[model samples]
Target: MMDNKTLEKKAIAAECFVEVPFFDLDPMNIVWHGNYVKYFEQARCELLRKIDYDYPQMKESGYYWPIIDMRLKYIKPANFGEKLLCIATFKECENRLKINYLIQSAESGEKLCKGYTVQVAVTTSDFEMQLVSPDILKQRLTDYISGLS
Candidate 1:
């Protein structure tokens, strides 16, 4: 685990606004539970872009990051057209990329959903899982975190 100060300095988060569309809702007029995964992806992509390590960059570095595990907890159902604010926070990236997400009402700020995803790096050519993160990832994260000092 990282110390408080290190966590604070290294922390990176991004927020994205989404309006529930009719197509995303189920017969009950509530957003489908599985749709939250897309929300998480949106926010996570934004966070990754902030550090210039988005998917394209990752692939360019010769690694394919595949999600190894994920979890989602729903607190409330969202209605169609309801505005939501999704926040994705970077948690850990030493050996793998771990990101936490929260979905809340844009108007009321009520928490509606929360979840996390863990991704492990694999070589693009051979698809061999990497026990340790690639140097490019480590260096970029280090630079970003150090910049917060």
Candidate 2:
């Protein structure tokens, strides 16, 4: 069951559909653990794209938002050829970008995995880590939230 906090994320999230390819399967025919990061990245990119703050735009704005931390919990094995619905929700963007992710079986709505990633902004030239999220990111997030209403 979803709580209010989680229900809130449904109002502010980006989604994508992915058909699991055979290449993504491990020897056991289940998706390998490491490949989940790539899946998260795809959804993350979609979230950034929705806000018009993807890597290219970030570079143009003179900052690089790199994943500084990540956590994942596997709930079930996803089989090859399964259609998956991936949701990426921008949960926070004050000190860092804290995005939550969910991968569910598109056919049955079973939650297969869940995770979150934290991205920290850094200067493109100096590589100086930012103490707070850059203005561009915060502004974009604000705009996105405003549009949701």
Candidate 3:
């Protein structure tokens, strides 16, 4: 078990609260393993929103940041109707966008799952991947990180 603050926000982070719905459960009465990715996406959206760079903004900026890889480690099972706290922390933006996630029981403060996703920027027009992330990402991260303090 970990404290609630263990996954607390940092300079570039966001937290999302989600309730385990009946549709998200499996026959075994626990959260479906695949649904954890959705949970991470929710937190990731919040994190990107904090930096004023949601999907729409990405499209408008002429780039598409696609998730290239993901990894998850399930620590415990989450039951339906349980309150969950999902945390996302932005980790990198130079070559790719990397965000780490943590999902825990809101009531018991126990870790349920942890993972990370990596995204690389690709030009929307030609679908060419950028070797380095566009300057906008770094600038937005810098602005958000500075504003946090």
Candidate 4:
């Protein structure tokens, strides 16, 4: 069985920090639930960029990865001015791209929210859903994983 270290080396992950601003809060002073989606996007973009598979690159490869599904669970509420550490982990990318996200308090290490997003590849010109991922994505991920080891 693969150990944690081996698994970590195979996975692509990136983290970004966000400070809850007053604009993101509702009247109750807690972050609005919908704002978590933006946080997830920020982390996911960083992770994809690390692998050189970000949106622009995907387009250049003649593929469009549109988010087909997404889910989020709130563990705790973030207050205004609270700092959050958002981590995005690439989970799977055989037929589709799946990314998991975790948001935690930067100071307390308490989990604020967690979620995932799944994207399926589609042809840019015809917009037809791809049954299999493009070779470019596989190659990019392969290169990124190899670097970790």
Clashes in model 1: which pairs? Answer: none
Q: After superposing candidate 1, which stretches have Cα over 4 Å from the reference?
A: 1-5
- Among all windows of 10 consecutive residues in model 1, the one with the lowest summed lDDT is 1-10
Question: Could you tell me every candidate's TM-score relative to the true structure?
Answer: 0.92, 0.90, 0.91, 0.92
Q: How much is the lDDT of residue 147 in candidate 4?
A: 75
* Candidate number with greatest lDDT: 4
| Global fold similarity of model 1 (TM-score) | 0.92
Q: Per-residue lDDT for 1-149 in model 4, tens only?
A: 22234435576689999999999999899999999999999999999999898999999999999999999999999999999999999777767888899999999999999999999999999999998777788788778767776
Candidate 1 lDDT score at position 121: 96
Cα displacement (Å) at residue 102, model 4: 0.3
Candidate 2: worst-modelled 10 consecutive residues by lDDT: 1-10
Which regions in candidate 3 have their CA more than 4 angstroms from the true location? 1-10
Residues 87-106 of candidate 2 have per-residue lDDT tens digits of 99877776788889999999
lDDT of 1 by residue, 1-149 (tens): 33334544656789999999999998899999999999999999999887789999999999999999999999999999999999998887778888899999999999999999999999999999998777787677667777777
1 versus 4: better lDDT goes to: 4
Query: How close to the true structure is residue 141 of candidate 1, measured as C-alpha lDDT?
Result: 67
